[model samples]
Every structure is written in structure tokens, then in C-alpha cells.
Target: MLASLLAGLGLGFSLIIAIGAQNLFVLRQGVRREHLVAVVAVCATSDAVLILLGVSGIGVVLQAVPWLLVVVRWAGAAFLLGYAVLAARRALSPSGQTLSVGTAASPPIPDAGGTALRTRTTLATTVLTCLALTWLNPHVYLDTVFLLGSVASTHGDGRWAFAVGACLASLVWFTALGFGARYLGRWLDTPRAWRILDALIAVVMVAIAVSLVLPH
Candidate 1:
């Protein structure tokens, strides 16, 4: 049982550590110190729900729906491409706003003389963004649902235990990432730093989108 739990935990963390839009958004929010806790909660809860669905045989249902995967792949690819373009524009444009980090209890504000845009990192947006990011990309289902579920399903009566382990891993990882990013934000407080990060995120999103579309 311990081994199974460890295996599930390892797999879950390994899979989520990859560079993706969801992680990028979370990191950006952490740096901005804007509703980081809400972001982490949404991410963790969404993963738990997905992991549960996967363990409950929804993975098999998705596998049976071939066209659904195709549609989702295209949609996800488009979304990634669009996001990359937007990131690039932000990086290259001089009109980008600068961000400042604050404590978890207070909201971060824009630099002096800059207009503050209403922060949209509320609980509703967090949940919606997480759901779309996790579900709209069929790759997520492929990984968490199909791959992880297959492994867990093989564990006989221990499958549920493995699922629980996987869920817990997500909870820990997202919590750490969301909070840890705030600590790392100390060095990334400048506008130039943000531009660089945005540029890097653009590159990563474009690269991943291209990889998805290109022939394996």
C-alpha cells in the first residue's frame, strides 16, 4: 500500500511539473501577489476532481470518444497559440503595466501614475480558468485520466488508495508552487523582469503548441 501510494504521488508530481499555461498563470499570479491562495485552492481542487473522475472510469469513456479528443486538441492548440501571441505582444510593447508584490492579506498595486485595472483573480475566475485549462486540453485527460488511471486500475483493490495518493500529491504541489512563487517573486519585482518572464512564457507556449500539431 505504501509503495502504491508513493508511486501515485511520484507520477502526479512528475506530470504537473512540466511548463504549461496553467503553471505559467499561477506563477505570474504569485509574482504579482494577487489572490495566490485562491489560485492554489482552485488548482488543487480541480485536480482532485479530475483525479477522482479518472479513477471512476471516466477515462475509458473519453477514450471511446475519438472525435472529442480531436476537437479538444485543436481547441487547445489554438488557445495556446493565441496566448503565446498575446504574451509576445506584452513583452514587446512598451505599454505593459508594472506589478508590485504585497502580503497575502493585501492586493498588489500598479506603479505610481499608472491606472489600476480591477484584479480578476477572484474565486469564480480561478475555478473557471482551472476547469477550462484542465478539461479543454484533452492532453490533460490523456495524462491524468488515461495514463494515471490505467496504472491505478491495475492495483486491484488498491486503486482508490492510489487515486487518493495522486490527489494528495496535487494538493501539496500546487500549494507549494503557489506560495513558493511568492518567495521567488522578490527577485522578479521589476518591469524588466516581468517582460522577460512574459517573453519566456510566450516562447514556451508557442513551442508546446507547435509540438502538439507537428507529426510525432
Candidate 2:
């Protein structure tokens, strides 16, 4: 049981720590300090739910209906492409507001004239975007559900322990990532920095979308 749990923990981190759409989005939200708790909660909770499903043998059901994944793949691709376009636009033409990390609830967005503007990334929008990024990506299903499930099944009666470890991994990683990005934001205080970040995000989104649409 201990071995299985450790295995799950290791594998979970290995799979999740890579650069991906979900990670990138979380990083962006963290740096912006917009709905940080909500974004982290959504991502961690979603991963826990998916891991549970996979450990419960839902992967079998998923495999039986391969078309479901195909449908999801296309939908994911479309959403990713749309996000890429938006990111590209932000990179090309950024809003005049500059980031101001504050101790208050909602940080003030100060423009060149020092006027405070409401944050553009609202709670509802942030939650929805986080959800879409978590659920729409077919890779999440493949990694957390199918792959992790298959690995867990090998643990026999210890599978539940493995699932628990994997779930913990998701929670830890997201919490750390969501909170840790604020420190990174110090370097991204300038508009040029934001533009560069957005540009990179756009390129990554487009590449992932293209990979989804292309033949395996």
C-alpha cells in the first residue's frame, strides 16, 4: 500500500508538472492574482474527481465509447483556437492598465494617469475559463483518467491508496503553482512583459490545438 501510494504520488507529479494549457492558465491567473482561490479550487477539484472516476474503472466505459473522446477532441481544439486568438490580440494590443500587486481583496488596476479601473477578469469569467481549460482538454482525460486508472488498477486492493496519493498531488501542485506565481509576477510588472507572456501563451495554445486536430 505504501509503495502504491508513493508510486501514484510520483507519477502524478511527473505527469502534471509539464508545461501545458491548464498549467499556463493557472500561472496566468496566479500572476494576475485574479480569482486565485477559485481557479486553484476548480483545477484541483476537477482533477480529484477525474482521478476518482479513473480509479473506479470508468476508463473501461470510456474505452467502449471511443467516439466520445473524438467529439471532445474537436471541441477542445475549437476552444483552444479561440483562446489562442484572444491571447494573440492581448499580446498585440494590450489594455493600458498596469498590474499593481496589493494586499487588498481586489488589487487596483492603475493606468498611466493613476486612475484605478476595475479588474477585467471577473470572478465568474475566471471560474468559467478555469473550468473550460480543465474540462475541455482531452489530454486531461487521457492522463488523469485513462492512464492513471490503468496504472492504479495494477495495485489491486491498494488502488484506493494510489488514488488518494494522486489526488493529493493535484491539490499540492495547484496550490503551490497558483500561489507561487505571485512572486514571479514581480518580474512581469511591465506591459512589455505581459505582452511577451501573452504571446507565448498564444503560441502554446495554437500548437496544442493543431496537435489535437492533426492525425495521431
Q: Would you estimate the TM-scores of all the predictions?
A: 0.85, 0.91
The residue pairs found clashing in candidate 2 are none
In candidate 1, which residue pairs clash? none
Q: Model 2, 117: alpha-carbon shift in Å?
A: 7.3
Number of the top candidate by TM-score? 2
**Model 2 steric clash total:** 0
lDDT by residue for model 1 over 46-73, one digit each (tens)? 7888888888889889878878877877
- Cα lDDT of model 2 by residue, 88-118, tens digit: 9878864523542433655577656876643
Q: What are the runs in model 1 whose C-alpha is more than 4 Å off? A: 99-127
Note the Cα lDDT for every prediction shown: 0.76, 0.88
Q: How far is candidate 2 from the true structure (C-alpha RMSD, Å)?
A: 3.5
